[model samples]
Target: MRNHLVPVTAAALVAVSSFAFAATQHHATGSVKTYDSKAMTLSLDDGSTYTLPKSFKDPGLKTGEKVNVAWQQSGTMKMVDKVTIQK
Candidate 1:
């Protein structure tokens, strides 16, 4: 029984580790829908919208433009990186 339990525990640990490895990282890429500098908002071309943080300080983002949004997980999700005005 002790010998059998060792293999079973090791197998279970491997299974759990595999699940963690398969987890998806945070990422999203889409065209810019709307970027309101005053409103601090960003709307992607994918019919999705996100509000920019007040700390965000950049330019050259406009409506109907292309953008690649790279975000980080913060409870919900927060934009940590972005590439705007891309083809």
Candidate 2:
């Protein structure tokens, strides 16, 4: 029982740490290479892809437009919560 305690505790810590990292919100600015309203995905000119939230409102995004994306990582996907077009 004592030997099993350490590994279990370590596993719990790893699980918590993974959620902590995932909760971190990230921001990026780039030119829009493509925007798919139906698919709800945004691709930057630099090759980074972000998935827009389902309830997200359109910010009048267009190809070649500069935007600031606020997103969070969910598993393998970067989910965008907000988008601000740059003047």
Candidate 3:
């Protein structure tokens, strides 16, 4: 019985961890509506806002420029992992 229980617990933990990893990354593409340098946030024309990581450097992001953002949701905020400016 103990041997069976151990396998079941390990399987359950693996399943739960898989779900966490699956939901950890997300992506978005849109034109920039606003960028607040002080707040370290970027707003898209679609109304979704993302919090840029502190280490993020200004990539000459401009208003109305199309951008692709790779990010993760942290609490009530979207934390950016990378930002790519579109041509």
- The lDDT per prediction is 0.68, 0.94, 0.93
Summing lDDT over every window of 10 consecutive residues in candidate 2, give the lowest-scoring window: 53-62
> What lDDT does candidate 2 reach at residue 15?
100
Q: What is the per-residue lDDT of model 3 for residues 1-87, given as tens digits with 9 covering 90 to 100?
A: 987999999999999998898678899999999998889999999999999988989899999999999999878999999999988
Model 3 ranges off by over 4 Å: 1-12, 15-19
10 residues in a row with least lDDT, candidate 1: 73-82
lDDT of 3 at 69: 95
TM-score (C-alpha, index-matched) for candidate 3: 0.80
Q: Which residues of candidate 1, in runs, are more than 4 Å off?
A: 1-25
Residue pairs with colliding backbones in model 1 are 33-43
- TM-score, one value per model: 0.53, 0.76, 0.80
The order of the candidates by TM-score, greatest first, is: 3, 2, 1
Q: What's the count of clashing pairs in each model shown?
A: 1, 0, 0
Give the best candidate by TM-score.
Answer: 3
Tens-place lDDT per residue, model 1, 1-87, is 998999999999999998776453455678776677897767777776565677887657776666777555445545445444567
